[model samples]
Target: MVVEGAGPSCGLIDGFGRHVTYLRLSVTDRCDLRCVYCMSEDMSFRSRRDILTLEELTRLARLFIARGIDKLRITGGEPLVRPGILDLFAALSEPIADGSLRELTLTTNGTQLARFAEDLARAGVRRINVSLDTLDPERFRALTRGGSLARVMDGIAAARAAGLTVKLNVVALKDGTEHEIHDLIAFAHAREMALSLIETMPLGDVGVDRVDQYLPLDSLRRQIAGRWTLHDVPMRSGGPARYARVAETGGLIEFITPHTHNFCADCNRVRVTASGTLHTCLGQDDATDLKAHLRTSATDDVIVRLIDQALGRKPKGHDFILRRGASPQLARHMSETGG
Candidate 1:
């Protein structure tokens, strides 16, 4: 039954006293490319009937906004690849107009941004995060399993021309990508865009050894400090990344060290998959089947109660360990979890 007058609460506070305000909601679990760190090759995607519809995703977004979620980031294997995705963006932008949502952003692979950047800007999306691990055309192609670097570059340019702020998300790889870090930083700074280096996490068996791919951000930071001065900044982007200012380039750089330095002590975000599974902790397996409640004729109060229960089960922190010949910490791929 549809229950009326179920007003919003103060906010979603977890058992650890962290007020949750940011949500990473996935629109689809399918991507255009097969990144080695994100998923395995020849993978199977969810059937259309298994995923949430645009209307249902929109309703869930509004419910989260009413419950004090200020920042919403739409993610996916590749969100733009989903058909009718612009409709979802337009629908979610409604909360931004009324000030219920502080930001409406997305993290995309940038293959389709050239086609939708203008529409996205018109729909109230102010900023976007584009994943670009390498700048070399051949390396980029190999890294993304045949993705076109030129396409990504064009999409980024189109996004900039459309007046949307862009941030580059790079996955730091130990396999000789360290030498390109300075170049990547220069590229981002030259384009007036912020860049963040992320350490590879053992989320799934991508057919590659985790130990070989793991590049600790702590060591990488020291290496970066040798060439350029990195001054720690107090700025936060409502996520796990720690900010720093590169004195040489006068640009912003960030490090996301899930293993080297855990940010779970002040965790204030939650993630929901395209299938409606609410994961309170990224590394943990505990999840609430939000689709079960969403598909039923459950009222707002019922949904809220389910969310509260899930938050109560949030663990203290994640235990991520990387060793030789070890399996992934979680069986579910990062793609499935809304990377």
Candidate 2:
């Protein structure tokens, strides 16, 4: 089902000329931990009936692969929590096993990775990003509300032990303590893994005043630049994060600054929620509901056309900017957005 072209429009090119080749698929919105930055303590999740079936998920992913999406990422409230997720993994891995999809990756909280790491490695998942904002047990519990830092640490160790290319993700808030930031850098250096520092996006309740929490990553970058001689790494993935290696530690750090840097101009990825809604840009609310189309008599070609219709009109970029009293928000939260 290749789109029958070798140009920008061959896959998922927008009017702005950015060739989209990455897909982030949210398998479910049910998370075991209520991270303070991601959701409210009493948040409600979608019912099981609303989620896409395993077959539906596979069909949608296959169509995207045909359209030239070489890299596919699995995300969720915490992707490992979904039952029958291994089946879905096996189904999605078929193309990769045969050399159709270039890479299949995942992003998770790491709380569940300890048990799933071996299975994930065996299922053809080669790379993963684990979210850990702090290393202190009390701080971890405070941020995630009952999440065990030890469990997440165990998960991290298991992921590495299973031979997975593990990367750590951290949300650097404006009010973060210097000790935690430095310690996290040290931790990554110890493991010899890349650490991606992400600035908080004003999405969902996350149970905090996002404006108060928002931090410009430039300062953090300067702070690290002062300590270590950093070397720039070339960008191969269309994802927005910028990379550099610490000359002293051989540890890498990628900064994904959506509000501060706004990579939307050159963004080359789109997202699909667990229930089959497609969002062309993370900073914009523009989305098309594809569940109805998939559940009906719609053909793959028709689905492809609908995707074209959505990407063709992709917004120039997200409009929300951080400022005093700014209350930037989206209709859907991080849970639904698949992070």
Candidate 3:
């Protein structure tokens, strides 16, 4: 019982009336590095049939754009690990060139970016955010298990050179390497890259023993001790973050805290997983299986209806961490959920 274009331009609308115009697409469930925080030693992956093909993704994205989805972030276990990524980017970028999409970006582990940064830039990728949990070489090696710190650093430089707005993402952990926080901020300032410190979410396959390491953002902010000015910057056109800025050194730094910040107040994003399920909230367990719905009813009207129904279920805020004792109930790992 979905209408084609009834809801406010955007494909979905939550009860709060926020136009969900942003979509995160997962192209693959494969990643090269086994980040200890993301996957465990005994982790296994989804079957090939569980992933959506590039063609299917392009079609779904086109549908989303038609419904006012102007921003897209191509995510994955690591998007670059998939073959013909440039080709996929080409297919996904057409809307951006024609003005159907306002922005196109990607988040990666940066291990494979050195090989494709320029190509991705040429393919209409305007921004790139890379996950770098720690700056120490040995810690990086231990955390990622099989990634080279030097290679990731080189990739960041290459992305900047290619005219891509490079963002450095770090997951602030209590036990691992909190001492490197200032050093990382300094590094990003020197390189003129926007940096983000994320609180560790509990949805990944990583062992739950380190749940205590999930440092609440307020403590991290206090640890910085007014080294830089934190402006009340509003969320801009791009879907990077809602609040931020680092005045002293020039580059911006955002504290991404799904558990601490709870941006759901102004949330405008809906995630479409690689398996074709639509999630209203990133931390919520509720989801609608769009693939099954599409198979039986491929009409745009029906799809929009399904999206609306999902959005209606979107929570006002994520209290899972606070209520569930810092552990998310959904068992799906981060890679599988397109984080």
Candidate 4:
């Protein structure tokens, strides 16, 4: 049911005047591959009882759409790894058919894309972001802790064949995978796919030193500009990625610099974990227990009130820093929060 006082004019406008229109809802924190940067080798995932059921997730999506969320991205440790995830995608597509939701997308590790790409496309997913750090088989396996590079590559091809617009998400690691940046860009551009290079954020203890892994995008951009003719483009893909057109490959490249550059001023997104924890800020621990409210059989009005209260507490920006011996800003990993 649509909230009575919710719409474009009276939607979720935070204190900083940033209107929230995007929701990144994580279906599960369980991933097939344990990437070195995202999670520890022996990660402990959330229990099944704690996660929101398919029915609950569908209801939450409806509530968010009623409150003027036009774009919804299904995220997770790996969204595709979540069982019955396609059903959720199919259910969320209802809003799209009714003109209430503008887009439905997801970010995946591409491990399962080869098997589910067609189903996802049929369920109204037009685009997807695949996390691929390196093209070399050995390096890819090392980064993903035994993930098959060939399998991911096949998944990308399958996604393309299934008529999904694929974007490669590359996490820039200092002294790690930097050597393959050019090849990755070439590979993505050749397939008419956009490549996003992200600076690794200190989110969880993956047994690796973040200080040694951190690579600022500002410096990387300069290095990239030296080789390719880059012209800044005023394009945004709903998240914090800033885009630029590479004149050499006639393709697009995105710089997701969370540390060196703060893209929070225009932040229009909120994340909900698999367990239904609503996070207003990625770097802040100020969150509302939405699952508690949901499990209590609260009325829609009461839930809406809780959501409004959370929005009122949204901070102006996040406090993400990268330094030697500096602990993670938040104990929850990006996987736990929603990738």
Which of the numbered candidates is closest to the native, going by highest lDDT? 1
Count clashes in each candidate, considering only residues at least 3 apart in sequence or on different chains. Answer: 0, 0, 0, 0
- Residues 230-328 of candidate 4 have per-residue lDDT tens digits of 999998655688999999889999999889888888899999999999999988888898888778865677778888899999998888887788777
lDDT of each candidate versus the true structure = 0.89, 0.85, 0.78, 0.88
Kindly report which residue stretches of model 3 are placed more than 4 angstroms away from their true locations once superposed: 1-11, 229-242, 295-299, 322-328
Clashing pairs in 2: none
What ranges in model 2 sit over 4 Å off?
1-9, 323-326
Please write out the lDDT profile of model 2 over residues 69-103, one tens digit for every residue.
88899999899999988998998888889877888
* Candidate 1 local distance difference test against the native: 0.89
Write one digit per residue (lDDT tens) for candidate 3, span 1-339: 233565335455689887778899988777888887777767787787877777667877887777778888999889999887788899877888888788899999998888999999988998888999888888899888878999998888888888999888888888654678778888888988888888777776476554666677788787775566767576564333555667777677787777656566777787888889887777778788877765566566777677768888887766545343444556787787786
**Candidate 3 clashes between residue pairs 3 or more apart in a chain or in different chains:** none
In model 1, what are the clashing residue pairs, if there are any?
A: none
- List ranges where model 1 is wrong by over 4 Å: 1-9
lDDT of 2: 0.85
